[model samples]
Target: MPFLRNAWYVAAWSSDVSQTEPLQRTLLGESIVLYRDSLGRPVALANRCPHRFAPMDGGRVRGDALECPYHGLRFDRTGRCVHNPHGDGRIPAAARVASYEVEERYGAVWIWMGEPERVAVTPLPAFDYLDPQENETSTGYLLTRANFQLSADNLLDLSHFQFLHPDTLGSNQMASGTMTFDEVGETVWSRRVCRGEQLQEFVANAYGVPPGMAVDRWLNVRWDVPGLMSIEVGVAPSGIPREFGRMSYSGHFLTPETETSTHYFFAFGLPKAMGEAARTLVEYAVDGLMTPFKEEDLPMLEAQQCALGDQDFWQARPVLLSIDGAAIRARRIMDRKIATEQLEQQARIEQCEAEQGGKTPMPELTAVPIDCSALAR
Candidate 1:
């Protein structure tokens, strides 16, 4: 999969790579070792040593360097082989291990898996209101074990919440309501209006919502790409009549853990869950509700992958209503990008062959500097 073309994927949270520990995560089938250096900056490196393939994560962070567990190979933040304990301090050009583009934003750390040279860390995603440093935010991560798109579909499929989270997070109202879509360049924002009791109360809590409100505010705007979202939810007070009120926004991120799995990151807090305190009381309740919803999703998505996995080329199933204009647009965009990337690769190979007058080995892609911050804008 050409996931690197223009997609943004989260590597780890800022809290993940503590100064005391090295975190290991696999992306696009590559194992990476991430850790904070002496200055508390996150760094990434391929989790292997060039000599005998020792797993680097087994090593410890000593001073500003990460030393390999096996051969005592030491690499700096840029993945430069700084010292070979066995061969004095001489560093060779071939001694360098592949490193990824790394950046910190919105209290999380991101590492690109594609050509590190082409990764741009400039455009990190935007959060609506819940500031990581200020709000009573809670953090959690899940390994989907399914295609990232399946998880995206799960998030985009809010209709399931009604039957899935009936007592807590579900909206009996949206059982039968309308869904709307607004396309933003390279990104899509979607909303579902489940007009009913709980939903009405939620709407009333809209920013500066009136004292006695009765309506269903747009609850979510799924950032239908691979960007993280910051959502602020305004819940109507408990005493408000069912006929009045609404829920504003709750933030989320759908990150691809692999082509087949995703990491669903979330934070819910401050006045949440009716009479009970949200940050304190609702945490467990929210987890309980989300746990089932997530579990219920596995079979459906896994089956989706199985149905299509064995093929050499991906096939598109017939589109339906919920797939909507945004999903359709996203697929089209992805297809175009994928095709362009392949064509570009082929062109490069053909050009290289022509230059050699015939059949010389084509050079691999050179890593381009990435501006990771651009996706947010």
Candidate 2:
């Protein structure tokens, strides 16, 4: 998939993995099986069994080890095949699958898909509001039949909300709102402000504001590399301070399952409704936000993917609109990062060949940190 492998990608929600059962998921075109050990600590490993290539997740969990479904070969959390059922109980040294580094944070399980040593250096993208003890969060997952980057573009350019989610999230004011975009390092920031406009029906309902109230609305989208977006949408009385407004945060985290498939993890947060029922608040927001995504955005993106086929988005030559500024910047940032990595890999291979006196060694990829200090804000 040529993904940014050295970054942390969301594998699943924290609640999705179980101690007694295994959950299998594909990320960055690799099959990953996630399960909690006997100690209830989350673990991620390659889903394919080393011997028969059977799915490990299809098997049962024996204490902390996962048994292969086809055979009784058991693999522990470190991906070592500990128990060999047949043939004198002799386990081959090669009978081990790759184990990925995983961390449970921000209500999500993040997996590092690259060099194990580099995992600790690349910090997880922070979302302080996702803490369960202090904030109420309801997570929703969608397996979209479109490239993950397309979903990133869809969220970065919120101008589509005016048309794509007209009944729920969109408004004419949003389309005509004054927008400004800026790029710092690998992160993009976009802000849109609309003044003296009637709030959208769903927005008013979600915030418990009067329907007919004239309000000033602000939408800010912060996009980090490899597709993690945090959006702040707020509205207050016309001509009032925006800080006094009711604010809600929506997280759009995209993990590539394949070139044409994506694992979408989304969460809706309302600060005003923190004391209210979590299910009620989440259901209300999901009905308003996710409904349109399922009905409208999915079809559009899927059709676009079909039309493009195997062609890259830039190669397909999509016409740029004014609203695409932030998305375009993000695309360019990713392209640059990928290109840089490739160049470094080639350089490493050449150096290895030179040092080995004309014999080429397998290239070792060194993780380069994408400057994203501005993204966390």
Q: Which one wins on lDDT?
A: 2
Q: What are the per-residue Cα lDDT tens digits for candidate 2 across 33-125?
A: 999989988999999998979888888888989889898999998999899989899999989998988898878888887667777777866
Deviation in Å, model 2, residue 222 alpha carbon: 0.7
Score candidate 1 by TM-score against the native: 0.79
lDDT of residue 291 for candidate 1: 59
lDDT of 1 at 170: 59
lDDT of 2 at 220: 92
lDDT of 1 at 91: 69
| Model 1 regions more than 4 Å off | 115-122, 128-130, 198-217, 227-248, 269-278, 281-289, 311-316, 354-357, 361-377
Question: Where does model 2 exceed 4 Å of error?
Answer: 270-273, 277-279, 351-377
lDDT string, candidate 1, 102-131, tens digits: 777655676665544455543666653345
